[model samples]
Target: MDGVTVIDHPLVQHKLTIMRKKETSTAGFRRLLREISMLLCYEVTRDLELTMETIETPLVEMQAPIVEGKKLVFASILRAGNGLLEGMLELVPSARVSHIGVYRDHETLQPVEYYFKAPEDIAERLIIIVDPMLATGNSSIAAVDKLKERGAHNIRFLCLLAAPEGIKNFQSVHPDVKIYTASIDSHLNELGYIVPGLGDAGDRMYGTK
Candidate 1:
């Protein structure tokens, strides 16, 4: 867990509990995810470098701090990752957006990419990959692998809930990328769902089967 940071803020914990409940409605679940995404954005960008700039207030001239470099890129992991994307954009409206669609191949238990689109200069921007669940880590790993192949060097992974096995597998393969999650749930079940996880995140958010 060296590179993993759990967002344990009181508000974050309370919101996550509401999200985990079996009875939460789709509208309510989506609202909570947006709010939580804003909160998580605060922590993840805490250490971003800033540079001082000359500026003028209404009455006088002064220097101000601004984030360094071009806007960041949020690489969402397909359908579910878009849930988190909605809120992160609230904080950084100018940041670039990328989408990666990957699904697990049941028989081989491996990740297969179906879609991928991103900024041409992906190698030059910091990328934050958002996905709701990190169950087996196969998809996350595969997504990161694809990004690295495209020349992305600085990358991070964020999720709402994760399992220890998933985290271990992710870190073992991508140790340089830090992981941020709200909760580390119990182990995954035989079918690959994280035990006690908030069900399928995409399904719950969309009220789909």
Candidate 2:
């Protein structure tokens, strides 16, 4: 809670409720996720630095403010993260995109890395890592581990829902990185799913299992 930001917007809350409903269809869940992700992106990037630059309007030349520094990288955490990526890209079309593929080992509940790709100058840019559900935080923590190993410094983690246990686990390992989310649910169940969560994000979004 200290370093985490809760979006708490009315629309975000409404969409989240719809998503949590077991009866919601795959198309409906994915659509709500996209809309919510866009709002989440808006809040996460709120403090980005801007610089004044000379610009010419149709009638006159003037100075205008524009975002400074290199384009941000939205580092999505595999298949589920891609859902959030869709909405975030809609907001920042010029931003760079990266993927870190990690999966949970069913027995151990540890993160397993399968793929990773990013810009060459990742260290010089602000990177926002996204995963829809921070159920265990293993994937998010491990994904950030890979990024730090590759020289990324400024990083932020965003998600649709977070469990208290997951937040504790993630912040314990990576305290410096900021976390943004729409809701902080009660707790994770025995099966590693967030209680009162929207269920398995990938499964719901893809109509799988």
Candidate 3:
């Protein structure tokens, strides 16, 4: 798909394997999510525009490359997205952070927006929405919808793991938004969880289970 980038880098694949194991500990899972997020950020930001500038490097004045245009905005789909946000921020420290809160309704199977707050100049910046799991893709879609409503035009979605069904649904709805993921699994289970998935990312990250 034009908008989908499956990150199969060795480090990403290795960490994903550890994350998929049933025996992975809570702390280990949390740490792996951060490490993988950093790797994903590298792939996601690969095409970022850079411009050369003259700078002095102690001995001589030389041209150095610097990021061009507006800084990126990292919009996290809480609270699972928070886990990935830390690592992404480490790589793009100057990137602004935004929060989009959405929860899946158990009865209706729909996303409910509880809280959504983004940068004022979202339309002028590239916004990367982070979430660990993309099973049903309800929340991610809704998050993007909200961002668009708030005038965000350039946006991308990043995740650690995703299901085929979720990817299809997301692509069908928002074909223009690029999606980057570490792994793509089979399908969502009967209970709407991604099969062979790393379980509930929020719970595993916080040790709430």
Candidate 4:
């Protein structure tokens, strides 16, 4: 909990509840995810550095605050991470995008990376990794490892739901990166899935399963 921030806005909670229902249609789930992600994005980037820029209003000249430094990078962890990416991009249209393809080996529950593409100047900007569920934390950790190997120093992890086990594992490996989630669930089930979770986010998002 030391490095975690929970987005408990009423709208976020309400949307999450709808998403958690098994009867929810794929279209509904995707819509709520995008809506709630925008809210979560608001909280994750709350502390971004700001610099005032002088601008002339119709009435008079004024200084307005704008984000400082390079555009933030949203590094999505394969398929499911892309769900959060849409709404986040809607909020920060100028943010750069990174895609890291990593998947869990169902048997071993270990991560395997097959694809990765990111901006060349990743080291110069903030990277926020998005994944819907931080269940075992293996894939998330591997994704962060890939980013750090590419010289990313400042990083954060954002997810729709997190398990205590996954949170502990992630922090143990990458304590420097903070975590942002809409909810910290009860625990992970034996199959490496979050209990009472919204089911396979990638499947639910795309109507695959």
Poorest lDDT segment (10 consecutive residues) of candidate 3 = 103-112
Q: What global local distance difference test value does model 1 have?
A: 0.93
Over 31-135, each residue of candidate 2 has an lDDT whose tens digit, in order, gives 998999999999999999999999999999999999999999999998899999999999999999999999998788999999999999999999999999898
- List residue ranges in candidate 3 displaced over 4 A: none
Residue-level lDDT tens digits of model 1 in 78-189: 8899999999999999999999999877677678899999999999999999999999999999999999999999999999999999999999999999999999998988
What TM-scores do the predictions have? Answer: 0.97, 0.98, 0.97, 0.99
Would you list the C-alpha lDDT of every candidate in the order shown?
0.93, 0.95, 0.91, 0.95
Cα lDDT of model 3 by residue, 80-185, tens digit: 9999999999989999999999987866768999998888999999999999988888889999999999999999999988899899888888888999998888
The residue pairs found clashing in candidate 4 are none
Each model's backbone clash number = 0, 0, 0, 0
RMSD of each: 1.0, 0.7, 1.0, 0.7
Candidate 1 ranges with C-alpha deviation above 4 Å: 106-108
